[model samples]
Target: MNHYRQIAPRSKEAGGQLFAQFEGDDTIIVEATPPKWCDRRNRYNFHPSRWLQQQEIRKRYSCGLHFVGDWHTHPEAAPQPSQEDYRNMQDCFNKSIHDLNRFIMIIVGYAEAPEGLHVTLIGQNSVQLMFCENNL
Candidate 1:
């Protein structure tokens, strides 16, 4: 629970300029990046390594804190994790020793409109969709 609090802030701001907000405990940690830049296309790229580094930095900084959860954003919608997102979650869990703790994955999508964010929690081998408004 404590770790969750610490990691919430990072989730809130995980997507470049977009905002990620988490409620629970009192600590929130966020690992975010500006929109990626593409040299050839002159566009943006989602760099997974950068995000992972952010998480590692957060974990390192909050040594005693609990590893609550994490999230990312989509340009247009709220947030939702993709298949790659799930793989990243699994990779994070597999590489860490905090498997016993609950981990969350959030994806900000842009399906219909802006300001749309979706959150999900993954444990063991199961995944559950979560509502940020509910905060449960």
Candidate 2:
């Protein structure tokens, strides 16, 4: 989370893919791949290239881990997801290649060194929001 500050000077958001594995029915998030932010600023878009790269990451882990969702840094003390977030999640839910029924989004807020991290689990008709302080 602290690394997000490297790009905070622009006020543009940074984003990437969330990689995870499962044990029984419990999902264990284990990795995140941070790619270069595309041309668009102020918003995070997991473009097709990002998704394709995630596929390689999944393969690198021998399919044990897969793309589960996404994460991004917001320029706020308390990040309020824009309509773009909703559209992204909905699009992911519909077409994500993984065998996931729910997707997780980690929204990191811009603050001092360590920021606040918000995690939202999104299903077809359900949404669960969780939060944690970025001590790092």
Candidate 3:
């Protein structure tokens, strides 16, 4: 996640989906796909290609990973979700067929871990912020 931060002057926004697995009471995030050439990126915004993301989801699911959520980067030190970001997340959660009750969204920012990461869970009827127990 840190590797995709927009730290450079010309770095465009970069992002991908998050994959995880449930173990006992824990939902451990196992992988994050890096931005691909099919994505549209600018200094202030990122637009991932849906077709490619779906392909990734299928491949990861075949490997035993579940499609847990989406992640992307922002140029700010501490990122916040833009209106478009919220809408996109909501749309994805609403349209996708999954057993989970919610989906996670992570916005990686220009600063280092925890602070630079805005983690949130978007449910059908609620949104909740999440915090890391340790420094990343």
Candidate 4:
């Protein structure tokens, strides 16, 4: 995830879906895809192509990976989800077919982790910030 941070001025916003595998009560994210060519990315925004994303979900699902979340990059030091970000994520939660109650959203900022990262869980009734361990 840190590899996709928009640290350089020329770097555009990049992002993709996150895939994970469930381990007892824990969700271990094993894949954080890089932005696809079909995705629309600028310094301020990342708009992943829904068709491509769905395709990825299907492919990963076949490999036993669960679609758990999405992630993107930002140009700032400490990235925060914009109102649009919240809306898009909520829209995904509402529209997608999934058994999970929520989906994670990760924003990677130009600075280093964990301060540079904005991690949140989006559910039907709530949006909650998540903390990262010191290992980051």
TM-score of each: 0.50, 0.74, 0.93, 0.93
Residue 47, candidate 2: how far off, in angstroms?
5.7
Worst 10 residues of 3 by lDDT: 127-136
- In model 4, the runs with Cα more than 4 Å from the true position are 132-136
> What does the lDDT read for residue 113 in candidate 1?
27
Query: Candidate 4, residues 1-136: lDDT per residue as tens digits?
Result: 7888888898899988899999899999999998889888887878889999999999999999999889988898888788998999998999999999899999888888777888999998789888543225
Q: Which has the better TM-score: candidate 1, or candidate 4?
A: 4
Clash count per candidate: 27, 0, 0, 0
Which digits, one per residue and each the tens of the lDDT, describe model 2 over residues 15-126? 7777787788888888876656442445443343654655566585686777787788777765657777867786777765556778988877765533466678887776
Q: Model 1 over residues 56-77: C-alpha lDDT tens digits?
A: 5466546544455555554433
RMSD of each: 9.1, 4.0, 2.6, 2.4
